[model samples]
Structure formats: C-alpha cells, structure tokens
Target: MVSTNPYNDFLKECQMALQNSIATLHLSIPAISFSLDAPPSPEFGELTSTISFEIGKKIKQQPRSLAKQIVSSIDVKDFPLMSAAKFAGTGYINFYANFAELSKITIDSTLALNDAYGHVQTEKPKNVIVEHTSANPISPINIGKARNPILGDALARILAARGHAVFRHFYIDDVGRQTAVVAYGYKKLGRPSLKEKPDHEIGLIYTLTSCIIEIIRLKLALEKQRNVSTEIKQKLQMQLEDWSSIAAELKGKHPRLFTELLEKISEDKDTENLINKLNQAYEAGEEEAKGLVREVCQLSLDGIKETLTNAEIFFDSWDWESEFTWNSDVTKTLKALKKTGYAFQEGPVLEFDADKVAEDYKLKHMLGIKDDHEIPSLTLTRADGTTLYTTRDIPYSLWKFRKADKVINVVGMEQKLPQQQLKLALWALGYANHAKNLTHFAHNLVTLPGYKMSSRRGRYITFDEVMKEAVKRAREEVEKRSPQLSKEEKERISRIVGIGALKYALIEVDPTKRVVFTWDRVINFERNSAPYIQYSYARSRSILRRVKETPKKFDYSLLTKPLEHDIIWELARYPEVFIISAENFKPNTIADHANLLADKFNSFYTAFPVIKAKPEALSEARLGLVKAVSIVLRNSLSLLGIIAPEKM
Candidate 1:
C-alpha cells in the first residue's frame, strides 16, 4: 500500500495482480479496464471484481474455467497487501487484505501525518473564490439565511485542504432599494444610538418605518377615492386595515422607535419620492447618499461579523456591491453586453436576450435542458433607469472572475433561474470561459417546524439568538453529564459543542434538501450529530490520557477481530472520501463519513478493551488504533470548521 492512500494503493495492486494472473495463464485478451470495488459482505474479503463476466460475453468462453485459471495462477508473493485470492461462486475473484501489514502502515502513517492525514493533494490546484451569505442589508441574518456562510466556509476549507488557493468572500448586496429603505428608516428615526445589537436595531428601524409609511400611503389613497367602485373600495379598505394592524403590532413591541419614526417621517411631504431620490443618489455615487447608507450598512455588518465569528466562520474579503457601481464596472459590463447585440431596449426598460444567446450558442442540451425549453429574458433595468439585482450581479461576477480561476456562488435554491440568467448574460458578453468556470452552489432553505419566517414583518429568529440558546442548552447537558468538571472547563466545552451542533445540523443534510431543524435532532448525543462524534473523540483522548505513555512496537497481528478490520479499512479510505467530497462540492460527504467512523469506533470499544486487554502488546495495538481514529475525527471536524472538544 502507498504511504498515505492505503486503500487506493490496494486497489491499484489488485488490478496489477489480475493482469499478472492473465499473463501467466498464457491467454491473449485485449486491453480492458475493470472496476474493482468492495464486495457486498466482509466475508468475501476486501475487494471483488466481476470483469471476467464481461470478458466472458465478449470472448464467448467458459467464465468458470477462466476464473479458476486466474485464481490458481495468481502469485500472492508479488502483492504484499494481499493475503490470498479466492474464486468465490462463478466469475468472481475476491482479495483478502493482509491486516497485520495493512494495520501497521495505516496507523503509523496516520500518526505521522497527524493533522494532514487525509488532505490528499490534487495535481491541478486552482485559484478558487467562494461568495455567499449576501443577505439583504435591511435586517439581521435570520436562521433561514444562515446556511450560506456555513456551507461557503466549509467549501473554502475543503478546497484549501486539497491544495487549492481558496478565498472566502461575502458580497454585501447594499446597492438596492432594500438598503435604501433601511437607510431611509434609519435617517427618519434620527439615526439614534443602537439600543441592542446594531443589526437588530437597524432591523427594527427598517420594519417600523416601512410599516408606518405603508399605512400613511394607504390612508392618503383612501381619502382621495371619490366615486370609486364598491369592490375597489372594499379592497382598498381591507389593505388599509392590514397595514394599520401591522403598524399597531410594531408600536406594541417598540413604542419609542415607532413614535420617533412616525413623527419624523410624517414631517416629509413626499416620503416615497424622497426614498426614490435616495436610491438613485446612492447608485449615482452622490456623497451624502453614499455616506448615509454606507454608515448604516457598515454598522449592521459589524454586528453580522460578530455573529459569524461566534460560529468560527470567517471570510477573506467583504466585497461591497456599491463599489462595483461606483467604479464604473457596471457601466463597462453594460456597454460590453450592448456591443454583443444581446442587449435590447424593451420600451423604457432594458432587457437581455437570454434565449437568443442560448439558441445562437446551441447550448440548450449542453445546459442539461431540452431544445424546446425557452428561457425568459432577464430584466436589466427598471423604467426609471435603476438597475435590477441580477443586472448588478453581472458586474460582480466579472469582478470575481478577475481574481480567480473558478467562482462559486452559494445561494438559495429559489435563485436558480436568476443564476442561470446571470451565467447566460456573462456568455452573451463574450466571457464564455468565465461563464464555464462559474458555479451556482444552490442549496435549499432551512425551516423550523411550526414556524414561517418573514423578514418584512420581523417574524423570524436571528442567528445570534439561536447560537446563544444552543450554548445555554449545551451547558445544561454538560452539567448533567459531567457535574464534577470545573466551571471554566464546562463553559469552554459547551461553546464548542453548541456551535458545532448548530453547524452540523445545517450541513449534514444534502444541499438540495430542506433541513427541518429542531433541538432534539441537533443536540442528540446518542446519534449522528456533531456531539456524538466529538464525544467519541473525547473518549479516545480520555483513554490515552489515562495510559500516559506511547506504546513501543504495537503488535499489529493481534488486531484480528472483524471490528478492528472495519475500522482499519475506514481509516485507510478516508483520503479518498475527502477527495470525493472536495471534487463534488459536497460537505455532507465528510459529515456522513465521520458519523459512520464514530459509530464503528464506539462499537469496537464497547466490545473490546483498549487498556485492560489480556496482553500488553494487544493493549498497545488497540491504543494505536484509537489514536488514529481520534486524529481523523479531529481533521474531519476541522474541515467542517468544527472544534473537537477534549472533555465534553
């Protein structure tokens, strides 16, 4: 076996052994590649191949004879990792591993490499960029929007581990009407000192200001409705009642904020026009507008960074969406697209001909869609000459490609269509290579049972609040489980356990599936949760701490049990699993593999003793296995941006 990739080396040796057998048998067969994989059961040895079955159909010979000849002619001496080659049933050759040598190589290599045990290096490393968590600057990040940063950070970590120059980024979507409305609300409320976290305070200001301004507009509309139809009047009346109720609710929760915003906003005669002017000025690079909006955004972002830091999610850059606009990147992008003849005027608004580009490029099937499937054109700007969200994203995408060979945007599943449009727009602008390298890492939403979150109504749970509650609950669990620990020790472990549980819950599910989050599922210590893996690691450390010395010359031959073999195989295959996870952009693969390893480790320790085994050599060998498992666990958790606690 190779030093680092023991399983992969075994696989390569299996193929070579087969070729050697065929050559010795004196059979002339054409060059054919065979797929070698683990058999259905462990009793069939380590790996099984059915290439003889395919060869039988092509050669029109007796497969049973061929199988017998190959097994009899195989020389086990040539492959040190193979103990024997057995011809199981018909047309099947199974190979058993030499566990003694395999175990020594796997465990020793694992301990030697330690932290970098499973980080297999890729031959072609890339300069990759990951942008995510571009939440609207109007409100604090809610639980539903929290998946982006966690997944994005994990992706960057995984790629970096695989020898890629990866960069994590957060795109601040503050160049839109949402930011304008929030800034307007902040200004109307006298830009008061924050009464809570900056994001929370800004959210309250935005919600109250929006609700009140809506009510005012509705009331004014109702006043001017003379001789209107009865049905129209009823609809208007219902709408006014809804806004009034929303305003009342806001006032009930924040009386001072509501009163302050109402008094200040009512003083402006044309509040809607003022907001539009602010939006236009902000996009046009006006000083007063930029100063006012950027101040509130920066404050809110500071609070956002605090929440992300608590979860150990950090970024290399925080790219402002407004900067692209101010630096003329958006203008240059628009002009470039226009020159490509894909940009056309649809009345007073501008539109990009996406379908025409797809048709011209003949990329419908290449895009995994049918030829008849029509793509709707993307709106570039409004009638008032203000750019849309995706229009601004075009320039931002170009900016990212300038600094990277590949760009991955971690966004929600709902934005799949818009992302497709963004890519098509890039291609239409003659950035075909950039479009090819771009990826939309789309993920589904996170939902708590019995709760529907709406940012506009301020009816959602904040990430900060969730982290605090998770930690508090974790502390209770820690106290119940280990009451003798010191307060500081318990506090430290609780933070690690709590934050790890939250992140695991978000990332364990497949990215295409919605996560139904609940505390019972997240903090469970007995199942496939982060706490389970962390506890298993802690238990391994506990055994080593009690022993207090490294074992000299562990007897690898003594590890003969099925559970030990299972663990050895898993530890050996970890590097391959990591490569699959990184190449496929799936963090859940690592999570899944970690849970399985933890399960097997627990089962082994439960059935076999590590420190109290009959002979000292056997005890030391088991300890070696335990240490290897612990190292892999710590590395896997680190890739997920999770901490492995030593005493949780």
Candidate 2:
C-alpha cells in the first residue's frame, strides 16, 4: 500500500530534484525532512535541513566543500520554491519558501477540499468500541470522573467523523465492593426508601460510613497501648456496632466479595475460607447472593443514566457483565484457553502461563513495558465454578474483535495492568485475532482540590453539580452581556456553551496528564480554551451579521491576506490533527489546534476590517474567511462533543 499523501507528494517532488542535484555534483548526501527555518528576522532562508553535516560525514570532506558542490548542481527552474541555498558553518541548508507558490498552494488546497477541507479518508473505516467512564458505584459523578468520558467521547466523535464506525460504551462497576457499602446500608440499616434519589441517598450513607470508619481506625490505634481501659474498650465496641450495622446493610444489598472484609472487621475475627465460601455460594446459584447483586446492579444502572445525562455523555452500548454467564460462547472461550494451556486449572485460580511471555525485549519495550514484566494471573472461573469479571469480558472482547479491525478500551491508568492482563489472557484462550487489535487507552486521574476523587465513599462532585454550576455562571454572564435576549434563548445558549466549555476544558489537556479542575480556567475566554474558540466563532458570526448577506458559496481565491492564509493553513490541517488525535488518544492536540486557528483569525480580524473593506475585493475575501472559520470552528467543537451556538 504505497499511498501518496497529498501534502507530502509536492514535498517529495521538490526533494527529488534536490537529490538529483546532489548526485550530479557528486555530493554524498540525500535530502532530509526539512520544512522551514528562520532567525528572529526574515533575513534567514525560509526552509532548512542539515545536509552539509550528513554529506561531510559520508565523503570525509569538509561540509563547506560539500555545500558548494551541491548548490552548484541546482537548476533554478527545477527548484522554483527555493530562491537560493546557503550553508552556515554548521552544515545547515536553508532555502526560502516561494511566496507566490505558498499563496497558490494554500488557497488551492483550501478551495479544493471546500467544506471537506481538513479531512482525509486515510483507510476504510471500521467499527470501534470505546468503553470509558466506567466509574465505580459512586453517588456523584465528580470532576475527576469527568475526564475519561469527555476524552473518550470526543475521540469517538473524531474517529466517526473520519469515516470510522464508532460505538461508545459506558461501563458501570456495579459489582464492585465500593457500591456494596451503600447497598449493605440499605438492607441492614432499615434505610430510607430514596430510590427516586438513589445517588443522593447512597451519597449520604457513604459519607456517614466513611466518617465512622475513620473514628474506628483512630480508636484501633489507641488500643495499641500497653493497658487499655474497659471504658475505652466498651466505647470502641459501640463504634464497632455502628460500623457493622452500616456494612451489613450495604452488604445485604450488593453481596460484594469485599463485604466479607467488613464482616471480619466487625466480628474481630479473620475468616480464612471467605473466598471459598463465597465462591461456593455463587456456583450453587445462591438466590440471596444473586438477588442482591441484581438489585444493586439495577440501581447502579439507574444512577449511571442520570450521571451521564448530567455530564452530557452518551453511549451506544451499555453491556452487562452478567450477560456472558449465560452466553454459550463464553464456555467455548474457556474451553479453548484450557486446550491451549494459556489457562490451567489450579486448585482455585485460573492462571496465565508464564511460558507465554515474549522473550523479545524489543517488542515488550515497544509496548511500554520493562524487561521480565508479565501480566498478572487471571481468574476466569472460581474454584466453585462461577465466572468472574475477566471471564465475562472475554466474550465481549471476542465480539468486538470480530466486529472491528480495532477495539479501544478508554480506561483509567490504574486499570492499565488489568487491561494488559486481560488482553494476554484472551489471546492465550484462542481469541488471538482480537487480542492483536486491542488497545488500552489509559488516562490519568482527575484530582479535586487537595484530594483525589473516590467514588467508593461518594466523596466527590457530581456531574450534575458541575453542569449546574457552569450553567448558573453562564446564565449570569449572558444576562450581563445580552439582557435584551429572550429568557429561552439565554437558557439554550447557556447550556450549549457552558457544557461545551466544560467538556473542552477537560479535554484540552493530554488525557495521560492529571487534570486539576478549576472554574476560572474552564470558563476563561482566553488562549487554548473552549471559550476562546467559541468566542472566535461568535465573533466571526457577528462580523457576518453586518453584511446582511446570506453566507454565499465559498470562493477561496479572494482569501489573499497573510491572516487569511494563516487561518486557511490551520483549517486545512484539521484532518491531520483529527487522525493524530484519534490514533494517540489525545483530544488536547485537536483543542490546541483549534485554539491556534482562532488566535490567528482574531489577529486577522484586528488588522483587517472585513465588513468595512471594499465590496468586491475585501468583502468577498472577508466573507470567505469568516465562512471558513465558522465551518472549521463548529466542526472542531463538534468533535469534542460540543454544539456551537450561532448566536453565542
């Protein structure tokens, strides 16, 4: 598949002529990847590469001699983009970018693509499953929980725009123990019937339990004294009663594996056979355990729906882990793994074979792993013969693999190890084809002020709260600026722009970097942020409002100014940015690019009055610039899962 990239084709042709010149002059060197170089002033040439040093090393000759030899073979007509070549003492080859060619190429490329300006259909699109924002059974969707879904959803949108079929999945960890605490409270504590506000109810329970647990820890620390008073011990016993009561209620609802730990803590006794007991119950189709899990699972799903709605995140698929237990294909996968010896039956745990580790350190290094490192042991089935989360995932992974050429798991970095292990386990079990295409799109944590967000205790902000705050602030700003605007109009624009700003702010940072949520930065109408881009788009619309001219069909020829050229350049680069962002799981790159384009357009607007310019030459050119800006801005924001309001 030797495909020609449109941008690179012209550069390759130019490089070929340079290569021929070097050969004709008997200079030992090839053209390198060179675009442009400039000093503080324009006196320096427009393009630069280090050909002199390369040739000097090859020919055992002075770089100056090689430089002279190469330039002597140049035919001016063959290298029209280059006015002259000059080599600095350090073997630098500098050539100027021809202004005439730059103008023609820039405008020509922009006009050719038109509305399809920045997109390149690089490959046949395939279905992509992006599973993200699988936060624990927490009551609130905090600022920290907000990062993954925003990035994952944004990436999904970008991939889909580039012709890939994208399916977004938002998984909820209902089976996990953290949610168990809340469930346990409901069952054992005679809790309030607050299913209508389940998240809030759970949130309150978790908060109270957490405070009590801390006090219990402090009392336990005091008990380390040589002699403990009976009075103090009795008080500790009372506290333990409170803890047990809460844990029992939560456990009665969720029946989580970790509930046994809470049980041991309350009883002050270790149960060594806890896993065995639980596994036996699970395998025997214990109605109580299954019923509890199912009930809590349903509640968690309800909470998830509200959370996502509040966060403005949507999913194409909400796969249930329980679905795989009854799936015949899951058994087939387990059998295949056993046959391949990728998974061997230990007394209780199913372990991945150590012999399967790839000896090729280079390959491991490429996958960002250190030497002698291997994925952790995977337990597909318990000793009692019930399927675990890993087993359930296998069928889902297999389905995704067969459906698409690639499958992306947009999960937290904490799950990176498990993700790698899952892939290895799946591959060992005869899901080799799917394993090869799996990608773990890991992202860093989103931290609140002075603390990391924890869903287990419900000690975080809810997604609804974040949106509400943004909308409130936005409404006030709208009223201050546009008081005459209708209430309905203000509300509509507020939600769109405010929510758009929040999503973009979270996404503008590299997903792998920890994000510190801040109201000022998110709503800042300044550089490298969502508001700046939105404001830029709105400013362009405002300029067009004066012309009273319906946006005409675009004519790129009128876009002649340097500012116009700059905006066009950025707009043309959109497709490349989209491809890179999707490939690298980096929405920040797209955000940054959009920011740059807006900044350039703003600069252009300041220098040139679009509406006030001559009707034929300036008006057409300005109109074209504004139209292009509007299209690119809307498209960029759309990729971030944001809607652009025309009037905002």
The model with the greatest TM-score is 1
For residues 471-500, could you state the per-residue lDDT of candidate 2 as single tens digits?
887888778878988999999888877787
The deviation in Å at residue 239 for candidate 1 is 5.9
TM-score attained by model 2 = 0.80
Model 1 C-alpha RMSD to native = 2.5
Per-residue lDDT over 345-385 for candidate 1, one digit per residue giving the tens place of the 0 to 100 score: 99998999898999999877767767999999999888878
* Predicted model with the maximum lDDT: 1
Q: Estimate each model's TM-score.
A: 0.94, 0.80
